[model samples]
Target: MSDYDQSPNYQRGLNLVKEMLGDRFLAGLTASAESGAFAADCASIAIESAFGAVWSRPGLARRDRSLVTLGILIASGKSAELRNHVRAGLNNGLGVEELQEVMIQAFPYCGFPCVAEAIEATIAVLRERGLIDDSTQSAKERGLL
Candidate 1:
């Protein structure tokens, strides 16, 4: 609290996000939570206050943010993170096709190998979440047939 420029409530929320996402990414996003960059402020504001306040504002839904963030991470070749955001995307309202589009868009730069592994990861996530009857079923469900 005090004059640390961060509220107790905000810091607690950031800490909770750290628990959910773990140190590696929280570090990645916040630059080790050391610097005072936008990421740090994002850790301070977005994850903490805005996440509870402005992000939850009346307009865009959390699902929308997840989908957009998923696309960004995928395009950036953050395959390790694709599954989490992909799963969140599905939960938030994305379907197989939407997820596929995200992967495909990354192909020009990320290449087939990354996209291939991304497909596998995403399919397994969907299957685990029961979003698809099976991996192949996704195409049929989307009429990609």
Candidate 2:
């Protein structure tokens, strides 16, 4: 059912993300991707070679890990990636404020244009995942939101 299933590498990478993160977040990534956008080989490399191979390396804990990836992705203006990391960040214990802080930190070096875009994309991701909501209490109440 996932486009990623067509590529061994994609499947491998997806599994690796799962192993490092969890199934709920991986499902979210798979469900969010579009049709005909990524070929099997590319997906395989992205999933297996890129994430599976490099992301799980030593030197970072899983919680701090997504934050680093998220920082780089946002700083680099990778809108497409915002969805994946935004969801992973929250699932991995990142609060909305933390997300904003990361974006803001990227601004001094990455510039307003990228920060603005990342804010839009990351906020949309937060909204879609129910990480942002009207029912959400004040920042003090949740201690983060």
Candidate 3:
């Protein structure tokens, strides 16, 4: 284990990531980071800073943070990151409708293509988790539309 792996912040970040994304995520991230020095450094920083310093802050709930992160990722057209965050959002207590609404709310500002990609990524995550099926009419349910 490295110094960071023993640090309180790193431990907290690792726990937080595991709580939200599960152990498999960290495994894949660790495997990828093992490829080179730069990637390892970057992963350490992200785990310590992004997950520990920012995510552990008391100002916002994890669900709220997930929403903001998803919005930014969507606006930036970061589909891959969006997919990961969609899972995080669900784990953070966001429902499937809320996830869809986030994309819908971003549609006007982020444009069709960006929002479309985000929705597709979100749906993939939802499907992976078995949260939605082909016949689910989520938009119109509970007057969400």
lDDT of each: 0.63, 0.70, 0.83
lDDT of 3 by residue, 1-145 (tens): 4566667887788889898898999877665545566578778777878897899999999999999999999999999999889988899999988997898899989988788778777877887899888565433342432
lDDT pick, better of 1 and 3: 3
Distance from true position, residue 105, model 3, in Å? 0.8
lDDT of 2 by residue, 1-145 (tens): 4555666666667767786557875665555453435553454456656776566566777668888888888788887777777877777778888888898789898987777777777767776777677464433344432
For candidate 3, the lDDT comes to 0.83
Q: Which candidate is the best by lDDT?
A: 3
Ranking by lDDT: 3, 2, 1
Give the local distance difference test score of model 1.
0.63
Quote the lDDT for 1 in model 3: 41
Cα RMSD, model 1: 7.7
Better of 2 and 3 by lDDT: 3
Please list the residue runs of candidate 2 whose C-alpha ends up more than 4 Å from where it truly belongs after superposition: 1-12, 19-38, 134-145
The alpha-carbon lDDT assigned to residue 102 of candidate 1 equals 77
